[model samples]
Target: MSEDGARDDGRQQRQELGSFLRRQRERLDRTAYGLPPAGRGRAVGLRREEVSYLSGVSVTWYTWLEQGRDINPSRQVLDAVATTLRLTDAEHDYVLSLVGLAPRPATRADAVDIAPAQVQRFLDALDEHPAYALAPDWGIAGWNKAYERLYPGVATTAGENRNLLWLVFTDPSVRSLLDDWDDTSRRFLAEFRAEAGPRLSDPRYRDLISRLRAASVDFDTRWNEHGVGGFVSRERVFRHPELGRLVFEHHQLRPSDHLDLQLVVYVADAETRRRFARTKD
Candidate 1:
């Protein structure tokens, strides 16, 4: 067989895998929802039309999906389908795995746990720069006093939902803080989608998604596109109420043994650092 032919065969195998996984998920959904069994049934579980309606996808597309036609679905589309089918967290992870996406590790929840003492010490150590610990889903797990002083909105809004993705996409204050709002929003949304695939069944995850979908059209659009990329580096210009436009280098760290909790440190440039020092005076 030719190399091209071999590649085609591999693609076909993946599609077949996706279709089988979808069917199994549909079966689980039917049983969970107490839907009728396949008693001489033409099709098991949900009809393609029903699944399409629930997922906001075209019936033809869904049909192609079930037929394993090498459809490259966006994370948003997969997420919609997962929601419609009421898939469990494990099932959602399996769906992502079938499509060759990063599956959320089984140890995520345990990995996110940061001891109170560690969190306190970490915050205390960040003497001047703003820094915070975020949960896997970007919720504010903990932060330094300097963070609150630098970003007062964090104190008031952090309680609302500590998720940085949700804030960038939905909050007006966050938009005002960043110079290029659109690009920042897109990058954050893509990162959120990638991180969220593993935790789809978490109530907090669903709630955050629902809120963002209702609040931001741009977020809703990018979310459905299923763009995936890990958080490598983010350069943000924060228009601090006291310090003015301060640029910070944002880094995402996975320190937990399970790789769930993310430690986001904001380091200021020399100018920004000087400004921060003057702000104290």
Candidate 2:
């Protein structure tokens, strides 16, 4: 890249940093950090001075950093700022990248590819339980028969519409299938937001967001909320028509060779496990 081009990129990154910082601050509650709550006519979230104090930096320096001024902060200062914002893992990485320093590579849709046959075999091996794989974009990359029966149409959905967020927000069947659809949807959205990271400015990510907004009002509202979460194992209860109530915990596992793909497996409780065996019989 030319010197001019590099300078332009730096300027753009600074602008993004400023915007992201403001959004995070606006959404954070002062009281959540043991600080005074917003008084009448004051800002809804923590004030700039409060953040500076908490981050152990001078108010002028924090203000300059937020204002997109040409000032480079040390890694220590950046880490402090990130802690003050209570950023998610992805958000923390993105903030570092904006300053021409990337602690980790950003996961993108383009990086997703067909899962190896070995991955399919692994999912197939878990025949008695539900198991599947999700691509970087959260698309249904592969699944087993048990997973297909578990989620119904999810495994069969074609094209990019197979995305988890798309199905959760647009598919009526999905809304009816999950016992706690609202809670599940919110958490999934938060996970998706975390993965999106600095790629939010990318055309593909923006297009996906636009389509999601058109598909569901709730998704749009949640997206605007800027909530972020990690993908971790969690227990969920499902109402099965023939089997009655079933409990299962799901986890997201990444293969050492394929960091972009996530293997999601559902483990049933003792009673649910018995129900699955009986249903198979």
- lDDT of every predicted structure (CA atoms): 0.72, 0.82
- Show where candidate 2 strays beyond 4 Å: 1-104, 111-113
Alpha-carbon deviation at 142 in model 1, angstroms: 0.8
Off by over 4 Å in 1: 1-104, 107-115, 158-160
Model 2 lDDT-worst window of ten:
104-113
- Compose the digit string of candidate 1's lDDT tens values, residues 169-234: 767877887788887777777777787787787777777788988988987888888888777786
TM-score of each: 0.58, 0.61
* TM-score of candidate 1 against the unseen true structure: 0.58
Per-residue alpha-carbon lDDT of candidate 2 for residues 132-168, written as tens digits (9 for 90 to 100): 8888777778888777666778656776787778999
Top of the candidates by TM-score: 2
Model 1 residue 135 lDDT?
A: 74
Model 2 per-residue lDDT at 238: 77
Clashes of each: 1, 0
